[model samples]
Target chain A: MRLGPALGWFSRNYNYEVETQAPLQKHSVGSQQRTPIMYASLFEQKVVPVKHSTKFRDESVMKSKRISKFLWVGALGSVVVVSGLAEKVYPGKVAPSSPAQTTNSASTTGTSGYNVTSSTLAPPPASATAPSGLSATSGSSSSGSAAAAAPTAGS
Target chain B: MRQVLFRQDTLGTSCFLTSRVEGVDFERRFIAACETFSERLFELDQVASRFRQDSEVMRLSAENTGEPVSVSELLFDLVEAAMRAATITGGYLDPTVGNSMVGLGYSKDFELVRRDSADGMHFRVVLPSGYRTLVLDRVTRSISVPPGTILDLGATAKAFVADRICAELEHLYSLTCLVNLGGDISCSYVGQEVPWMVNLTSDGSLDPTSDGMLFGIAGGGLATSSVRSRNWLAGGTPHHHIIDPTSGESAVVDFESITVLAGSALDANIASCGAMAMGHRGIIWLRGTGLPAVVKRTNRTQMDGIARPWNGSELEFIGDWPEELVQLSGGVAC
Candidate 1:
């Protein structure tokens, strides 16, 4: 097929027409480049500029090969992208929000140098300091504004 | 429950971590954990602190050529945590405030900084809300920042340090523990009848703000953020450390102080910082997290974000804290 500036689109679209085909080359059908409409009726090309030799469909085969290769590379690239995201170090999950937090019990086996507690507790006394950092304390005041207008907590 | 208190100074403020136990070995192990905690804080400080020119944070800042720079694992994780806070706060609590701090004469330590008042002073803070510009590669443990942006991991990193210390205690000794970096506090307890008592003054000034009245906590963390502490004079006007990224100015009007209890020191501090910066409307922000909190405003109004028993007369509590009372920072403790 004769090619020119108009053929630039052909290169990008993986549509290559076998420009030089020896006469009676005996080319196999598999050697042709494939277009999306390769199976169209031969009569459809009668109005086109180029001659359509039944044996010179090598361009159509070439296009199919190129298209498949592009797809494989894209699949490989997508896998790499996903793997990268999976390995991201974001600690995204249920943030220790609820009153009960265990830091994923399975992940925390107390296998590290820390010792695990085995003791049970009795409910805290009214005057005792609770672990939640709440309590009725006996301390003098320094910040009047904060204390004077301070609101009591009740639940 | 039995209680033990440990205090030290590191990371630009006082460090407090609590442990509960009875036996003799408990003190020994608790002290050991404290030592490890102090070491970790120093290690992180050496890596993530912007005030120290020799810190990795400064090195990264100096070397930011719009290219990714390999950093210590600590710094890498620190930046990630700060980014998380920036995300949670909708950019109100930014870690990239180094340039903004410097713009306000906070280039040096707080004590070393000169307070000439902020009146009549014209200044521009680059990327006051630019924490999003930080590029972090967790796989490579590398980070990059936009040109002219400052990466300051003050609260996010500081709060995490507290959480990590408590986690470390839980990991090795499994000892009931609380790690407090300045006013940020974290605790871990497997099972106990009596909760840890953390006292707060009625004025909201001396709760974990100090070590006074008892607030009951079984686990998790607590923190207080206030602008009353880090005040400075900028051009004849008092300036503070907390800046509203949107305005590039101190967030003085938003709150006088805020105290929060959450699952970890990281959550507590990040939420409080964000709430403090949001001003009083931050109450809605804190309430959204469902964490228990108290906000003290400049007008001396107290608001509750969640439920807690305000039984003692000495420790006052306002009934049904309003969401729109112009809540401000109770105390700015990062």
Candidate 2:
């Protein structure tokens, strides 16, 4: 198998060679309902039916187009994974922009993991909510007899 | 079977009876019976007692200073019964010995009299009676008596209660029932499929080993009176509560115990108490009653006979016997 790979005429592409000549992977309303997330790639495939005969022929065509469409999507995902690795080696030049950039940026900003550093917060109010039963006449240590009198009423 | 036993230590007597087939609300009936009887018989107490206010004997005692007092129907009935007992026993048992009882120190309630003094260390107190000094008017229900007369009915009240309870239970529950007022037992059998079983022993204080008991399968009341139960010493003399009206003293009977089987346990109880009060001649007097009787003499001798349908032989065992005392062919007499 190694020698076969070395010869140019006998070489086969290691990357996926998708069959684009097959019918456009047109999705039925039932298939779209099954997995709504995967249907976006199916809409991009644009598959068409081979014949308008019985349901058997139409189903085979639909099945064949759906399988190829899935293979194409998997191949595209592999490319994205390889590109991510390449970006890690080459920095910002290999990175995908916009939608992927927003997701990556949002995740990194979430895990700051430090309570000391305030990203964004409001300042404390000038005065706190009033104590219902009594008013502190002075500081926490009680500056005068008025503070004692004000709290003594509660006791 | 349901039973409610009432024990008043003040009276020194036990009132116990068995009830069957009473409906859900039988407590009211039972308590009513107790209250009615207590009202009639509680006079012997020195404390403010119902008997002092209700008894004709007490009324007679009260009027001893001034004019003689006439008796009420309730008091008359009790006194007449006492008189009859005295007459039948030939003064062996007498209710008229009130002064003698009081002199012996039984004047107050038996429970209330304190025995702290050394002089009365061995003697128990009974009320004294002024028996001989009484003028009677039978038609007017009045009696005049001397002062210091204290009447005690510890003997007859139990038997009367047994009879009264039987009558009450018969009317309340249409079933065979028995009331044992301190072992003077009275029973009434409503139906006749089988005879009721009663244990007849020389004394109810039984020992498991000895054949000192008999089973009576009669359908009436039975009572046993014995000096073996209530005995005390007074003035260095061994005296019992069973008094002889003739002598105005405690009875001196030879028998350890005497049981009479009659048509009613009331009859048996009265006869037995009277006989015990009769001293030595109690057996002979009981024999004249024409009822079945068994007497266990103080000398360990015993006599048994079935003089009536309700009477039977003295028991020889403490166990149950299925056989009833059937009357023999030639009609038996006392």
Candidate 3:
């Protein structure tokens, strides 16, 4: 295929072009004739700008690959940090201690033992009392009249 | 000091809000307090009512895929309260009795259930799925239940709301308030000289002239759970609302009603329901807990050797239940 016109679109869009250098020639000096030392031939050059379309496509592929690599690394790092924090904070899989074990442990430590452990997420009752916050009506009042009264019924 | 009263129908029962306020503008403060209480009750019904199709609980039940569904803060707290009640009551007052309740022909409102005839209705004994099977994630504020496992919070939700309303009233208005939802009552106040008078009745009748016990409470919660008032017939057999999770049947106790006092209305309700479910052992259990309670046994005499030897109706008071004030023909005096 005739590549130049076929890849004309790439050149127009990317402004990429291949340039060829003239071959090295021998030059005469005052004492001796010296040949210009060629470090690398045009073909042997690392970045040989051959075809505009091919170079542009290769560069685009390389750029995408770099971005994808960074993305994968970033995603893996996020997973690691999240999982570590979750393990430390929640520990959802940790089995609760049995009542007997808790009591025995407390007894061994010379602490007051209870049937149920105090380490729970349940909020305490609204009253100041521990288990049952119920108390009797305080003081005897013969003068205080009933402000409002309601009947007790099961519903 | 001026006293104000507010009444509304809620949760298939009557809710009464009584407030004692000092200073001027008593009417405005009472109205504001009532509005707050009403709003909270409405929110709770939207979140916790099992009969309502649009409620959060019914929605959760519809999603029976055995997956955790995120719930609102109100519902999360309510369900958490139910779980706490179950834990404290040792599974006697279990929320997992929803299936049992429906199986016993109480699928609708109590009034509707009463209107329907139970001639040909077949009552099945549906055992509870157990509260342990329930999975609640506090961090995510989500709940998960096994497929076909329904949760009914009737045993504790009303009392929980009463406590919530009393607390909200005290915090918002700083007024001495008494919140009574059905028979679940909660009183909130700082320093008050007079205690709120309560007439204890088992037959759902609120009459000062009737021969009933009148007591006083300054703080905490007071709740009454009666098997007598909410009873209905199912296929020639009678059943009540309180279901024993062990048998998945109506709790048949010797007691006609049990009234309890606790630090919070939720606790009082739990204890009362638990005591009713425990049957004859309820008195012993209440004594162990050291909560003031009054248990009234059924008036009917049972057959010999069938159950506890019933010697007619008896009123048994436990702990430091206050002295009952005599109700005279004209008025009630201490």
Candidate 4:
């Protein structure tokens, strides 16, 4: 009965944590193919906990390392997000580095709220190198040609 | 060499001009053909536009005196075409659904039509009939509809324009060609081995020009009826332009978009709209027609009964598409 106060103090002072981690993954080659600016979500999925621990370190030292790591991740994430936005906002500026494989057929499925901003008559940004994503029919039986002449169709 | 041109022409829809001709001036000739094509579409709009109060069709709806009045060459042709469409579609593609359109808050031009009424006017009930009351006096070159009927030829007007102009352009320019008004595509480049390939996409309009599905068509026409856009909220309920004559309300089709390829743009347009108006039964009707088509629903893509890996290339048509377009396999007799 006398030990109850001591137990309560220990419980309040210590942190018990269980973390379920999704496996760290690299962006699929298909995902990376959409160049000029790739979506931030691509990297968000790849986020790996660079470091984790229960062992205590010098308070000042731990804080400094954490700050540096936080800054690094934040800066990289920001760059990815900003670049993706830039590529999308001004898609016409860049050549379609690759015929990006759309998440869904925009024409058949009505453009949802988030994608409305990217839907435009402006052609896909021009890319100097052949952008990746066009291999939709690569493994499949179909041969998807990049230079296939589509009839000049209108919206 | 194959060449393509895109233009925003008459009928308030984007027009695609596809040319495949060898030896010379394909680009110049294609542009000129589009110019002529656009002017003709404008003229047809003036004569057939129900949105224009002064147009012939609108005038008829506004002043249905019921007296057999002399009709113009265009009006008579349009009326005949409308009746034919209604007949082929078994009233599924009713031209007299104009009142239903107005009742659902699309009374005037689509752009001019208010999405929501200030008075909170809306529809939640079945509407009355209009097509059954129309009377055409072929002998006298006149037509009449019941007093209350609103004759909107929209169900088939644009298709007729596409069909007419496509044929005109091919013969006039002496080149293989295609005329795409939004999704209503009329093509006639049979001699060229390579068919006109169309991939329907939607940016926001009824038919977006981005990604959907690719259709390789030769000699015939294709049309798409998608319920994604040109819709609004009425009484907090969603309403669209495609109205079912039987229900007297906007159709409740299972598919998000239906694209049909028929012997003519008119037939393709009728089948596409009729499929939308018929709801799920539209697919059955299309199957009966045996025309090549692609229907994209919210979850699945389907086609007519046939096999895959058609015509050499590795491409596989997603649906049950046939190897080639059938003339009419036990289809709804048009």
Candidate 5:
């Protein structure tokens, strides 16, 4: 039992017939109103004889070719759409551009450091007095009195 | 000049506003300013709170969908400011530590977490995905994050809000104001002769006699980050809210607290948090930034003893920190 010839015979007879007839039958085109033969015959030998043999084989092959073309196109389109969606959904994972590079390259200012060159320490406010029980003291430059001090701590 | 002070509690912390207004309609303007501050704070919490299931940040975390999510301008600005903080600190103060916070037994609000016992609590080391993974589009006011990346803007949100509110008050009411959210402070300058006096403490205490130092700033922001605050115990181990993104654990540092002064509250907060995360390297980083800072470290020997005096602590001043003016007995003054 040679595997090559057996597989070829199986494909040409069973697979080819199923592939060719399924689309034409689904389209509801009768065998009599067959389109003209467009391409050469794939298999020169015939196992079974039927009416309009040329038309049947030609129409079937043409229809099968049309369907195959459509399938190839549809498959290509699906691949494209799926790829696009994946890119959109998983942008960071898909196109992993370095964050460091992006941050460094960003033209935006005030993103890299404190905006001020140096911190400022001013004298106490004038004309503001501390509430009772809290002592109000001014800094070295005693130009103004002290206001109620705001407390700052870790939270 | 007449000055008014307002205080309220929101966003799980206290907020203070100090304004100096000189006008005949001072009463009405003061009331209106207070109302505006409340509205802005509520808006910030709705958009940025991590504990609230309905908040935009929580929803974004729950969805875990890597798509651009349109958010309010406030939230967008918050995220953008957080990312800027990450950039400035070289990823030391990261916003993408939400999962890390939960894993460290801070899964709920700080107050609630403090109430619950940590006897049988278990945790895993959930490292942050890094802030760089976040994609923000300014044009659309949308943000995108990687799936499973939880962002906690706790480091910068309050400071950002303080800065925003201070700016808003100044812009809208023409008032010289200072806004303090929790420990983050921002003030507006109008060439006034008096500077805003701020008490620096390791713990967030408003008590004037609490062993702390005092400093005066003409304008800008001040923020303090400490390991002593927002700390809890999990499975018999101590944990803090500040998560080191590199290790996915609470930062272990020698200093008990670090306070930074910058042009804005957001900047100050970022520097302080980044310094905390950097540990010993923080001093060098802080010096390099040329911002005024005061770092406090508890004396180990003093802690060993039963009684710990306030003077037992060591304070290091850096980058043009002013000299002590009025010193409280046994406490450092700046």
Candidate 6:
């Protein structure tokens, strides 16, 4: 096989390509011999530190689990605290008129700074105390004679 | 079902009427009618009444000379009625006479006399600037008249209200209704009594002696206009507000009061007022309206004219009214 084609095939098969190659050096002796550095000190330095780092990573993992548990407990505690306060604020009816009413009551109770007055147009209820400044109630007794004999003639 | 009673002071009289209808709220309906009447009266009051500050008569009295302003819908109706009456009576029932009456010393309404003083009395033969110059445009509701046309719809306003109220009640309530505005009566009810019982007046009081003599009026309205009830002496001369448009003086008519029954109270009132104005022609003009009428004080004898409905022979003359039931305002004869 040709050297170029075989090298290309080998490079293609292995997915490797060389950008540049170093030039071969001629030695004064019969041949120049190359030796690789053993690097045992670098290996010792990297390996020991990696084992200590793994132990530290295990401690960080334990800390993350504790933090997640704390967050979950805090969320549940907030729900219980709000519901307890709401019971005192809003004494809601068990059987409400509609879903809209339920939503309104819930919203009204939770809102801390909002209050609304009811309608003023209606005649105050019989049992309820009349509002201030309104004329005192005169019952039907006052209108007996005039009401009975009125509208007698047309002109 | 609720019943509504409406009461108001208007058209020179107090009006009281009741309405009971199913599925209707009383106050709303009653108030609506009353408000409409008030609004219409307010508009007419400006152009028709001698009273009220904004009345056309008052306005003219203030300015003395100004072009007759554009008339409103209410004013137009009143002016048209008055003009027609003036024409019918040949100018006996003149509308332009606030100055004449005031000069005659009867400046205020009869109801407003609080111990009448002679200080305001000024008797001068001040003539009313005749109704001929007062031009009306029905489409625009505008009136152009000569300066100082003191228009007063004393009789006509009552008649107009009677007609208007009857028509309005029939439309809104879907029931037979009647409106009697100070004896200018109109009705919508049709029943066994085809001709309604209408009383004739002698000097603004019920003609007790001629009550039975007067004919019955069915379905239509009856109105009687008279100078007998409201006459007083001004500056040592007898003066009445019903001024004759021709001489610009009070009419010296043969009849004390003329009562006419017509299809509407407005027609009756106008005809009666016209009769008072026309002197002799009033009777003939009233006959033209094809309604029954009764005229008292013609040669000191009550001459009653019943329309085709009532037989003249059958209507017997009744004697003086019972003492207990003598009405202060003459109209009903016993």
Maximum-DockQ candidate: 5
State how far residue A13 of model 2 sits from its true place (Å): 99
> Residue A112's C-alpha lDDT in candidate 3?
18
Which scores better on DockQ, 1 or 2? 1
Q: DockQ (Cα-based) per candidate?
A: 0.01, 0.00, 0.05, 0.02, 0.06, 0.00
Error of 4 at A123 (Å): 34
**In angstroms, how far off is A122's CA in candidate 1?**
26
Candidate 6 at B277: error in angstroms?
2.0
DockQ of model 3 vs. true complex: 0.05
- Candidate 5: residue A52 lDDT (0-100): 20
Candidate 1 accuracy as lDDT: 0.52
Query: Compared with the true structure, what per-residue lDDT tens digits does model 4 show for residues B284-321?
Result: 87666655566655444354434333222112223333
**On a 0 to 1 TM-score scale, where does candidate 5 land against the true structure?**
0.68
Tens digits of lDDT, candidate 1, B67-88: 8988876677677767777777
Candidate number that wins on DockQ, 1 or 5: 5
Candidate models: Cα lDDT each: 0.52, 0.41, 0.60, 0.53, 0.61, 0.45
Per-residue lDDT over A131-152 for candidate 3, one digit per residue giving the tens place of the 0 to 100 score: 1111223332221233234334
Which whole-number lDDT from 0 to 100 does residue A32 have in model 5? Answer: 21
Tens-digit lDDT string for candidate 6 (B1-334) = 1223233344344443333333344334544554454455445444566655666646644664455455445556666666766665556666676667666665555544312534334477888887777776655656676665566677567676566666666567554444555556665534221122333432254222332322222245557677755677656677675777677778777666666655556666766777777776666665665545555554443345432222232221112111111122222211
Residues A1-155 of candidate 5: C-alpha lDDT, one tens digit per residue? 11222224434543222121101101111112222111111111111111222344345444555665677589679877876888899875542121111111112222322222223222211222211111224232221223434444445
Give the candidate number with the greatest lDDT: 5
Off by over 4 Å in 2: A1-155, B1-10, B22-56, B109-139, B146-149, B172-176, B191-196, B200-219, B300-334
Candidate 2 at B296: error in angstroms?
Answer: 1.9
Q: Sort the candidates on TM-score, descending order.
A: 5, 3, 1, 4, 6, 2
Q: Give TM-scores for every candidate, taking all chains together and pairing residue i with residue i.
A: 0.62, 0.51, 0.67, 0.61, 0.68, 0.54
